[model samples]
Target chain A: MTTAVLQERTHYLNNGYGLKSWLLTKDHKRIAVLYFITISIFFALGGVFASLIRLELVTPAGDLVSSETYNKLFTMHGVIMVFFFLIPSVPATMGNFFLPMMIGARDLAFPKINLLSWYLLIAGGGFAIFAMMAGGVDTGWTFYTPYSTTYSNTYVIATALGIFIAGFSSILTGLNFIVTVHRMRAPGMTWFKMPLFVWANYATGVIQVLGTPVIAVTLVLVFCERVFHIGIFDPALGGDPVLFQHLFWFYSHPAVYIMVLPAMGVISELVSTFSRKPIFGYPFVAFSSVAIAVIGFLVWGHHLFVSGQSLYAGLVFSFLSYFVAIPSAIKVFNWTATLYKGSISYATPMLYAFGFIGLFTIGGLTGLFVAALGIDVHVTDTYFVIAHFHYVMVGGTVMAYLGGVHYWWPKMTGRMYPEGWAKLSALFIFVGFNLTFFPQFILGYLGMPRRYHAYPPEFQVLHVASTAGATVLAVGYILPAIYLAWSLRYGPVAGSNPWGATGLEWATPSPPPTHNFDRIPVVTHEAYDYTAVPQEVEVV
Target chain B: MSSEAHAHAEETLALREQFDTAEQQKDASTLGMWIFLITEIMFFGGMFAAYTIYRSAYPTVFAVASSSLNVTIGAINTCVLLLSSFTMVMAVRAGQMGKRNMIIIFLILTLIFGCIFLGVKAYEWNEKYVEHHMPGQAAFHLEGTPLQGPAKIFFSLYFAMTGLHALHMVVGVGILLTLIVQTRAKKFSAEYFTPIDISGLYWHFVDVIWIFLFPLLYLIDRHLPK
Candidate 1:
């Protein structure tokens, strides 16, 4: 369909008006918007905390705020960003909006449950926000034992409860995705015929379903130990603190995949579509997602290596951790190979994809460094670890998230953001993100531990550099928020397939109808069969 | 059958707008429930892992604490839950048979047994409270054993596991009550009983959790001397 025909059509956005239509709607597309709005608030809140944290670290002394406030700042930052923003970032927003459309389904299999997942996130986030406003939780986002269960004078229970409730939200979304992929695929859309994005999401769903409940129960144990003195993780009452680490990271390590795998899926799409080629080694990339989810489980013990976890167990864990990297490496190599000799474009989304590849490599490599018992002992609690995850989460996940958002913006909103501004922001984020995090690797190697409000004067230069990059990153993030909103009202109307992409979602009108397709599509081509896709003339 | 008649029958099947056919709807509902149950397993699995670890650490305390639980009431509650599971199946069968009255009767029966099990659980907990076996309470005291402190751990696990199970039972009761209302409203038929089937799956899963809870919480080291 042309842009003229699309202008007269009633899409999901115009389907209903007013708050009630949105708040009570069962449509997956509406629910995704609800998630987008909610997580955006959370992202802004998390970003504020990050800015405060960076500002504090810019000096050698903790002069800006008390140590306690600083502690709460980072804690809330970690909690909100990981649980509320990053984990749900791509999956809940882009994944939710597009998964059904890609699979040629009208909506997710469980639309009510899909809506309920959004509400659960709000309710869970409400408890967390309540905790934050009501004195704030300072036990750190990990909620390690003794401090969390026995000694911390904060809202540990409220925060943990919030996360506990949100775990169900993740589980429900995962459940919806799994069932949708299994039962709602269009005719002839076999498992392999589905996009890698769906496969990655399906893998993420498996982790969410299997792993989230453990953390939910772990948080419950933390709650019981704190309130009722259950003594599961409290060492004073014959409980093992190390067990808390085991249980926490069991879900949490896989949860790292939960955060990154969906981004990898997005990267897959961005790389292939922008490169004008099919994914290289599709089965390998597809299975690597499942591989990461499974191997991701066995490596949690690596977190406990310096914590008196048995030497043999640590050895086993360290080995398994290395194994997890192989699949990740396979994906990186495959994406790079997909780009080889292919007709590559420098779209804003493709730039983000390049950023994801470069930063995720650094993140994944540092993960291996930490996975090794010898290296982990040196830098386990240092700025190196912080830099490592920020590289993955902020660098990898956030970059791909933006890339996917930009790539699919037209399909989602029927408007193309200003190309020049979009590229400028992407450049700002790329340059800014690297500047912000890379110096931390040096400071960490020089022996600066994380979560400290003050540091020696020698670390100030690196901290200042890091803080400067953060300012630029902030500007980078803010740009999209401005332009995307602007584009919604004033940007050029986007035709159905702006990128000439090869997914079912793009086959429909921009801002697809409430029923998604006029008639259910039948898949007759391989994924990213760009040869059959008529190549549009390059708009220079 | 005429195409219009078949289409009307399909509509009467109550196939949701999302599903293409009744079988697809049935499959999706059943699959969704099974996946949810897997999550439930991991939820309880976390506690069970803690239990196994702590039990191994303090076998004597766990044995003593296990003995202190009222076996008679525990056994009786087990029987009650088993009977409830039976009634739940009967309700699902009634659903499939399209016996509206039988479905309601069986659901009510199952709900009653669920309540009876909970009522017995409350009585047992009250008895423990009187006996000072309740951990974390100021009056909690276990006399004459080196395992006194660890016995608190046992009681903590006891309350945690049983309390969580009881919470599930409460939710199960709520679900059954909703099914009862829906049944009364004449929502199910021979061709459309997916909700009833999935609810039965959930109820039975709760019952199965109790089956494990019964032996692990109540019957552990019962053969040991007092």
Candidate 2:
């Protein structure tokens, strides 16, 4: 296509103007952009809270902020990061944008509902930010029992209300995905022929439908208990707090998979595309997503090992936790196999995929370490536990999110980011992330606990090391924000399928036209079949 | 199925831009409603799980607390809700018949029944308040035990469970009102009555939740006497 032709051809971006056009858009692609911007703001806010935390932990003395302030700091950080950022990171932005196109549909099963989901997230986020501005909640994101209901005087109601409202957004998005996948697949796009990204999100949609509602009700109970003295989880009124743990973790544990499963999906695409080969064990990889979703639900009890849960129940949960590892490992092994004997390119997105595999492996292995009955006792509340999750959530999900964005940046914006800077940021994030969290593993194993305001002199060295690495990681995060924004206007126009990728999304012009396809595509080829993707398309 | 679809092809409405066919759009809408209803079930299921755990832990207190409620009023409320569900089904039937006036009329009847259920619920709650059965209040007292702590747990669970159900009822009624206006505008027909059909599913779902709530809250160990 000539530059003159590309300029004259209208797309979703230029088809409308003014606030109403963007805000009232039922277009899934436009809604995805809306979500991407909203979540980016929340991610930055969460990062600021994190920087303050790392700064506070630089010395053993808690001098930077008071302990009470520290409590609110970490609590707000967790609330914002988990609910507002990581949970919506990939699925809302990338999944929403690509799932429809990947399956050869023009929009989701419900486009108006897709728009509504975005509004719900924003409304929920408004409540969260208000709570933060009103001096923040100190009950932590978990809001465990008597402390949150009977004791804490902070803004528990506001924060929980935010999360409660946000829960609906997740459910609606999931509902839209499941229905679209089932009823809206274009002609000849059979179940097996769809991309792994769709399968992963479809599994995620199942989890979201089943798991999110429980958490919504749990938050409602928390609100009722705090406001009306319901005493549901308060012990003084003969209420059992342990049951609160049961209800909370039931959704939250699966919520982890909700966060990472989409990331796993992104890695599947990155691995297949960057290697220029079909993902090895495609059936196994696809089934592994559903396997992970199913197994993810049964292991919520692992979080309750030391919370006065019975030994019998703990054993059952512990064993079930191990089963989740099998499907996750299967995905990792499959991606690695796809790499073998394939023409591999170390593109920026693939760099992030490489980082995800290594970091996610360490994260998963440490997860097994913490899942053990005996080892969990030693490190349950320690920095070891902290290290395990950050590795997965930050190292795994964030890496995959960035990779997916970079991989599809051209299609999303019709522009190419500076490749040199992109790879540089990926390297910094990988190295700096390891530097920040790896010491926590050693510190945790050595008896340094988490959520602590102060620590002993021996722990200071490691804490300082972690803080330094965090600073580096912050730089890596900021670089992309600058370059990606710059790329919007200044970067070269990225031709459709710049990297010569497969799937129906690449078949459309970059920044796909309104209604996605010029006409709904008929998908007769298997997913990731390179031959099915025309190589004649122009410049990267 | 093809012949059936073809026979009704003239009866179908204009297609949504996204879907390939009107049937596809209708199927998607129907499936979306079923999934939404299932989510509502899970939402209530959480409260039920809490109810089960606590009730088993304090069975005697739960039974004692449960028996003090007016089962007669509860039974009447249940009947009111069940009738509303039936009216909803009738409204959906009227929609399928494409009698716009009948759809509007049955929907109004269903809405009235829904309001009746809510009115009865408000009255029962006021009765509890007057009797000081409200949890965590100064004068709050259960008839049976001196501890009242376990008894308070019962009332708390009662209010929370029913409160969530009531919230859903309110939302259901709101949806019905929207459908009523759209029906008045003749926005639907025999082949395109999805909103009515979907709202019927939701209204019935809320009624079924009340069915479970009635037995679990009001009829538990009734043979033992108040």
TM-score of each: 0.98, 0.97
Candidate 2 residue spans exceeding 4 A from truth? A1-6, A536-540, B1-14
DockQ of each: 0.80, 0.80
Model 2 DockQ, alpha carbons vs. true complex: 0.80
Question: Please, what are the lDDT tens digits per residue for candidate 1 over residues A1-540?
Answer: 345655587999889899999999988888998998999999999999999999999899999999999999999999999999988898899999999998999899999999999999999999999999999999889999889988899999999999999999999999999999999999989999899999999999999999999999999989988887766776766778888988999999999999999999999999999889999999999999999988888888988989999999999999999999999999999999999998899999999999999999999999999999999999989999999999999999999999998999888888889999999999999989989999999999899999999999999999999999999999999999999999887888887788878999988988899989888889999999986676553632
lDDT by residue for model 2 over B76-192, one digit each (tens)?
Answer: 888888888888889999999999999999999999988998898889889899999999588998876776888898999999989888888899889989999999988889878
Tens digits of per-residue lDDT, candidate 2, A73-92, equal: 99989999999998888999
List per-prediction Cα lDDT, in the order shown: 0.91, 0.91
- Residue A221 lDDT, candidate 1, scale 0-100: 83
Residues B105-143 of candidate 1: C-alpha lDDT, one tens digit per residue = 999999999999999999998999899988778778776
